[model samples]
Target chain A: MTMTDTNRQWRLKRFVQPDEILGEEHYELSESPMPTIDDEQILVKTLLLGTSPAQRMYVTEERTFHIAVEIGEVMSGRGVGVVMESKHPDFEAGEIIQATLGWQDYVALTPDDKSDTGKNVRTVQKVPNPVRPLTTIMGLFGQLAFSAYVGIIEVGQVKEGDVVLVSSAAGGVGSVACQLARIQGASKVVGIAGGQEKCDWLVEQGLCDSAIDYKKPGQDLAAAIGEHCPDGADVYLDNVGGAMLDAALQNIAVGARVVICGMISTEYMNPRPDGPKHYFNLLYKRSRMEGFFVFDYVPRWPEFEEQLREWYSQGKLKLVDDVFDGLPSAPRALGSLFTGGHTGGCVIRVADDPENIPAI
Target chain B: MTMTDTNRQWRLKRFVQPDEILGEEHYELSESPMPTIDDEQILVKTLLLGTSPAQRMYVTEERTFHIAVEIGEVMSGRGVGVVMESKHPDFEAGEIIQATLGWQDYVALTPDDKSDTGKNVRTVQKVPNPVRPLTTIMGLFGQLAFSAYVGIIEVGQVKEGDVVLVSSAAGGVGSVACQLARIQGASKVVGIAGGQEKCDWLVEQGLCDSAIDYKKPGQDLAAAIGEHCPDGADVYLDNVGGAMLDAALQNIAVGARVVICGMISTEYMNPRPDGPKHYFNLLYKRSRMEGFFVFDYVPRWPEFEEQLREWYSQGKLKLVDDVFDGLPSAPRALGSLFTGGHTGGCVIRVADDPENIPAI
Candidate 1:
């Protein structure tokens, strides 16, 4: 069978101003020759694409740990896909994989490429023992799940009888974090989300002991948290860091653990917003606020994967996947993360996996 | 020998507005009968009164961990005094003891009373083996030293080759912290202070590798810190937590530890100032900012005391005592802490130690 002649890609056309919307003006859709693989490489067919707030940092002119997504280049991101053709021994043509698959439908990954430097850092690996509903690879067993593990288990160190609070609790990582906190023996898991719908879903699905709809105008954030967590939060997994973080700070118990996973609230500001005005509460309560990157824990992903799989099999965990239709919907999927459009793990369904493997 | 007929006391008359000076208007000089000790209590003759910025909190109407200092009450404080007479077995005449002696010449410390509650909380104890220049007991080997121990060795976790930065580095806690960070094997210890004199003193005394005079007109604090800590600060011991904290946050290295010992810069403000604006750097650098109270580590004071004494005896540490004369100077000494007027541990020399004790 002959593959399509041209590759479709969403290239970052220019660095968007923080005040500007990340739309087609900043990103351009382009068609190019399909990427050719070498003897030690594999060509991947993208299946599912994950969207994260951190992606906003990639398109900025300022450089972070990874290089900025350059103008006229494929926007870098993580995704789940299947190996279409492989010249590498570790990967077969039908095997599923997850890596920095970027914005293209197809990607040529060199399994033996050791030159991941400044501007060229790619993490392409074959998925081991593929899970059913392959989106689980990106939503639960992949980077998203790994980040939640790092924040909940490592950073927050949630323990039995601890009152755990999570902000943006209906979002991708927040959803998994709430479940993980419960599985780790937290006596009370409280969630804070934007709308009543997401908040209702959190409590109804038993993901949290209670949920507070922060967008409910006239409702005080700290007061609501105090009402739900009578003893105050022992571990606060903060994804949205603005007024919500300030509120979390106010309701934290003495020696509370505040895990700064993401600051989605201030990510789009031109000159960053004023910091959490209640940060001094950290001093008053003798609490700790810490931040981390999931990449630091990449070496231990296998351990996290195994534990997550066990939790899933025992019916103690659920992956709330909110998948958009096709590759063209990827940008909107990413945009929706900022607009609070999705309830759980927001991902774009790129294409269907080959039917050679037996369905679960 | 018969002492004076009356006891001199400074009573809190009213809560001073943030803009007003903590002067005679806020306090009233009063005379009262010397406190009588019960059979289980010891009579203490106050010798050295230590003044701290935390005293401002005591005068506030707002209650925190401790109750507010009420009007007509003797100003609450910590001091070193001699046991004038003792009915309690734990104390003896001529022995130096540390306790919440308040702003009075005499204090009745009930060593065996054990009825300390609410506004009567007294942390009274006999000074073990008494370090020389007895002022050292209240300065370096007392709570000041304990705070530095917690900030430098415990919270900041200063280690070999770590570049440690400190704010208000000329004051009591910060001065000791600078030395402790160096003794803990920090390769570079930088300090930020007001005026050229204190900055020069820090470098001349080898207390800091370099010093930034924050009060220097038009100097960009972040740029100053960046220039001093070329590789960025590995640990930041924050005492003056306002703009200096924001600057420190901006110049921290990846994985840096920020120890928030105090926020003297905003303590007297009726409405607290905005928090450190560069706090998001904690997320960007994957760092940690933690706070601790010295009282929390009281059980470990023996360890800290032993180490501090050893360093003092070995000439590795020095107590930069900024002593004001007489009980009347206590309020000014406390006021100086916020005005950046004192170079070291500010204390009021209430009276001379008894001649029975040898002057070393």
Candidate 2:
């Protein structure tokens, strides 16, 4: 493959308003001469970019998140890339790896330099083996899956006979969490999603025993949850906070574990919404609610990857990606995370597999 | 001493309204023939009664609590009593004991008969080697102290060098929790109370390093907590929920443990108030919030009592009771818990120590 002389990129235009939908308007697309690698740097071409609800915080006007992107700087994101040229001994051309590739076609990375993203996973690292339809690497074996691992296995502690409930069930992390709960011997797995389609997709994919469509007309969330979980949820994995979290709290069983993985619904709202009205249940039921950042388990990522990869190879887990072709689709793809317009792992595919890489 | 043949009693007049204060009007005083002991039962005369904020839930019209008091039935409460007559081998006529004596002059108790009060501690048990002023048993070595122990030690996992915070800090359980945090090697302890007097009492009694008056006009609770706990609270024992819990949440350090012991602020309200608005901090700070019912620790009470007694004997702990004299003051004493009209462990003195009991 021949390398291009110019690189296309998207830069932050302004910070997002709390209630605003993140879209192309918040970013500007431009072209620049390809960047060159210095003595200890490597030139890498982006292959696929992952989208997360947390990305919106990086561009907020206030420093809401640890990692902030100033206006005019490249919009920050994580992605898989192929090393094109290496000035460092540790990396070689054609080596597949992952890092904070941002919203750009190519980047010059210093492997030993620490990332300011507040995420250790953003540090440049080599991908052991290349897999065909590389979305599998971004979906089943990437940061998204690690988040699911920590939230469901480590924090949620989903165990045998547990009745697990998951919010944002059709989203990337939620999808994996549902499956992990089942694999861990959950008696039942219930998923809550925004539309009938997503709900149907969840059950059809065997990701949940039952699915509750949150958008049902005049839906009474707490009542609906009670109907599905007559004995109450033994473990609740919350992705979309606000009302959904409150509803789950009302139906938790004794000694329930409520895992807070994300709060997409109210995270960006300037005046945040009220907390769960039924949090008092935590005391009534002798339960606990805990939150964690996947990055905090950086030292154990390898152990998590080993278990996840084993499950994938044994046909116990499957990769699900909603792929948007090309770098230009990045912003629109990210906006879909909050709009409920996409399912599975939302990702932007910037390029095809290199000639000699074997397809899985 | 002479035993009276007439018994004066207080019965429930009506269920309490959500927002109403518990007072004399809710109870009616009447006279009845003295209760008699059966073959396996014992008759006991009330000595002193202990009050807790949880009692309000027992009288709510909606059966909001596990143990409910029916209208016209004797009001439920726990107190210290002395046996007047015995029918079983384990007890003698002059033995002092603790049990659910209710709001009455005398009671017939079947020691082995299980209590339906949803509390094992309420079952009839001998007060070993009774101490004079017996208030010491209720304040420093009873259920109140047990609640504080579980919250700060077992649940909160407070360790040395930690900064601790307590709400309702001058109240029964809160007062004890502040001292436990110190004994556990906390570097600093801050207390939040309603009035300047209570605040001063907290620091003056050495229960807190500093105290915050939450009733200060136009006070921003979060700001006040931040000023006293500039580095953030590592362990927060919350007795009053609602807005106070929200304020504490805003000032928690990473990995902080917010123990929800009670939610007296909104517990009796028909329409409970919104939950803490800043609960999202549980995620932002990778923290945990847990709730526990003290009764769940019944099996371990003896263990807790042994340790608490050791501390009291070592002068590492002190008992503080806000006493109201006479059985006629029971209603008012219970009411003071909700009105913030009393500090320390609130208790009612029905009769003085028997002539033969030695003073401490």
Candidate 3:
């Protein structure tokens, strides 16, 4: 049965330029009625909404869109949905699918629609699973885990007993990488965080062996790196790539590998910061630096998902997620990122997945 | 017969800032007679002077001693000299050697010294080859060739028919990389230069299919990159890394490899230039960017040198040197680099190596 005015669709109002006004109004959530399913179209009921820093950038910043988003368009997002009714033979009622379903209660899709979600979207490709609750594809286990994995395994090529240095260690990505390095057999993992609290917790929780707080003014980063990693860093997973990258470069052991995952400092900059000029250190130490993105391994997701799932199942990998409540809370959740306020991965909980959310 | 002449040496008189007096003028060429040769030492007559950019910064500008070159210290350089006397086992009567012979006509050293070059030092490792001109080693065929080779083959991993982009294409490293890319089976090599003259010469010399003058104002770099490379670039050998690197990031084909050999623009700055902020492209394209030093591949020198020698012997890779005629010309020669005045490798010719220089 179709009901009109039962649910409202939240939409992106307009693209904001750098100097333009940031929107002050709430999302235009109009209680739109569900439509009749056509012969080719399947009706979808969204189970969970995905809200992220990326989503906010895609909506308000405009820089995220290679193609312009329409002013009155439905806000873009990905969601897990259950088919309530289906006219398409491929989809059946109660079957779950994931798609770019927007922030709404329901959606009708044709068989040939580009946004159609037929296959299982349970895990990010290359990002292993069972890492769900403590961490999963939804958080650092999925995305940032891959970044650290590629940085250490593929680019950095970590070996047994190797010292690994992670910057922004208390943050979503860095914390997962610290754990992953250990699971991958790194001898020691040294974390660089912004405060004493996170630093103390990272060591206490067994995620990292040692931690250093960078917030103390006049703190010597190189000395700290050297002190924490006496054997020197064989692999460096760089999340904040400014002065931290320079410190890593300076203290790198021979044949060291530096993996560039993200440079948050450079992102919001009107003009980027000047990198260190003494790159000759790469020559002196015979070390290597490489940059990576997790998305490229989409073709090999099944392998990673299964492997990480085993790790999660066995308690080898922890799924650490800072779960927020809903769509409207997205901005505040993301803003916490810049201040180093969250740990593990940050995700939004759309609904109580009675079957999946696990009644505690 | 020992010719007794006052031995002279240049020294950085006192500590000064980057733009301060680079020269102290009180170069006390030692008033004492020539130094006595030890059992392992060889005395070689230096005919010309070679100046390196790093030497200038070390002697006059840089204060932080990453690698300290103190005031009153004997200036260091790679000098080409003819061995007049050898108490050591390795040298022959009239053999030419490249050694750490400082900035002087004569430098005394033992056979075990790191810079005791009795053969062609193509890279960090010395490979003996008697048939080629001595100037080939002193000119573009030695250390610089190593820079180009490492950048293209080892770092860029350039394949047959791949489109390669070379920044500062007509400069020392770039010139060598251009020729090497062609020899290693690249289908197209586009050169990026600073002026119309250098661009024309690069194309005319067949080092590049075409040359782009980046100095031209209002040149839409992204458009230019797109236009020149109709298909995306497979290999990018970066020399100019600030904005050019930013543009190159946008035009990479999937699985593209970028070899960061030199950031010439940033090197000369007192403080380094702005680094690229939107580095997430590395993740988006699944492309790889690596920073390489020619010296790091010391063990693989034989493998690369053999290939380079074959390419040179077949006339596929041409080595060109822009020679400045005198000792005083060293400053001007170095200064010309920042202004993009030299079209190829800049070499200081203090003495006429008529036996070697005329062949090219």
Candidate 4:
């Protein structure tokens, strides 16, 4: 073959553990030129990226759903980028695009986000990031925000004076759920966090009415939820589904609602988790438990974004991001979620502005 | 205190397992010299009596709940008796009474049932048995029929062409649930039985569209449900919530509903059962699992009953009773549930007919 350079890419040479870096030299960068666009394709430049614990698990070859990345495959992630070139009528050159974009510096365009194509294809929606910080929308407000909103408001169906329990209370989805339950009129939000700091943060943010530190070894979460919420939890926003789901199951109030969001506890295991153990409490308490994927709420996003923005303007929906500052550090920050590295949303800083892409 | 003569009463002196009959010898028969009635009470004459597995499990001390006989308590059960004397306005002499009349030939005044001295203390619905069988109305049709009807029609919300899985398929609740599911628009019904005989009977009675012998070692029920149900089950009437529940969980189609009617498999354990290991399947499958106590649907009994009686009259509802003659074999029949010793509803033949007695 002729010596022609190629498209910019973050090639996944091998998987790494939590203690290991993705390596500065791990990614190979080259570009012959930008590709000519089609009527349906839009070329977008990488902007800010959202790192997830799932990505870390995916990278380590621990997760089952993922096919182990071959010797050279692009690192997977969801990110916000700016359209550099667009032939698609819906997208413009300068317009922003948010997608499950991989760790590459540049990615080709495709509207089929859910497909297995190498490009980070997704149902790209224009998230107006001018009113608030774009970083929040990219990090806290988008993925985690919608996760909490859909899980709590819709799935959990929280009501006024109702008690709510959120596992991984200081993490992305749980924190957002805690805040949303309060906004929606939850009487008491008891958070289950990893440490005193996180628990303290939860209570201080007014997101939680009380907090139980899981890091303290054994904080009888059921007892705490029972004590602080004498009425018992009407809505349980479960992010950590294994033991926390079991604990919440025991203390479920009559007609309680359990929102199954994610199970981070079992996500890192070689085998999936065993029984949550206390789910029979659902039968005894006459409660209902349901699961939801945030992507299922995309059509409702405009409505959610409107209400969420209103809450933000009213200081009801506060955003938090435990952002790491570099592409090389992305894997480490994302790994923190499973390894207890961060206390909030794990987001990676790819670029400060949409106009900062260097010429090839 | 003056002691009365030996009164005819069903007493549980000790707990016994299945096949071990707690015969009349195990009970101390007493003959009362016509006791006087008191305020808010009515004396009743001996009449028809039957038994249920719940009472059997309780009488045998093989259950988690405090279903103990208290060393000499009348074996708790439901029966239809005649009122000879009445001091309570709601109940009068010569009026028949139906409460959780403990396993006794004749009960004294005070229509107390549970711990409640007054609540749920009245006759559910006074009845004059005519043709189809009084005990059938009082036993199978009373709670058993209602259990199946309420679960499939009320909770499972069975729809036309919906596939339903009934665990403990040959037992009381399971057998009834299968029949009710078929009646309530279910096009396909699968019954998980303990043996080939039970499976054959289930299919013969048209209780299930398909049957699986759970007693067969190494039978993959999940695979069977998947194979038998190509579209997946829309409703699951689960009476045996154990490993079978795990299989059901895996085979549940998206939006499928699980009606947790009973958990016979795990009921006897001192410690609570560790349910299906893959319960989070509820989340993955976007399913809803709900448990309904038959007591909760009592108010709707008139509506439910009118329809049920209509079904029974139309020969739409199947009455499966494993009748054990006399109170001697009652405990043995009751204990048959755990061992899968009997098929359908089991009733104890206490009397040929009931007579109305006058109030004190």
- Best DockQ among the predictions, by candidate number: 2
Angstrom error of the Cα, residue B14, model 1: value is 1.4
Error of 1 at A138 (Å): 1.0
Predicted model with the maximum lDDT: 2
- Model 1, A270-324: lDDT tens per residue? 6877777778888888999999988877778889999999998899988887888
Q: Rank the candidates by lDDT, best first.
A: 2, 1, 4, 3
Compared with the true structure, the alpha-carbon lDDT of candidate 2 equals 0.90
**What fraction of correct interface contacts does each candidate retain?**
0.67, 0.87, 0.34, 0.58
Second chain only: TM-score per model? 0.95, 0.97, 0.85, 0.84
TM-score of each: 0.96, 0.97, 0.81, 0.87
For each candidate, the alpha-carbon lDDT, in order, equals: 0.85, 0.90, 0.65, 0.70
Off by over 4 Å in 4: A1-8, A14-36, A54-71, A112-121, A139-141, A218-226, A355-360, B1-7, B14-35, B56-69, B85-97, B109-124, B128-131, B354-360
True contacts kept of 4: 0.58
> How badly does each model clash, as a count of residue pairs?
0, 0, 18, 17
**How much is the lDDT of residue B360 in candidate 2?**
28
**Residue B55 of model 3: what lDDT?**
46
Candidate 1 local lDDT, residue B53: 72
User: Per-residue lDDT of A64-90 in model 2, one digit per residue for the tens?
Assistant: 688889999998898999999999999
State how far residue A233 of model 3 sits from its true place (Å).
Answer: 5.1
Any idea what lDDT model 3 has? 0.65
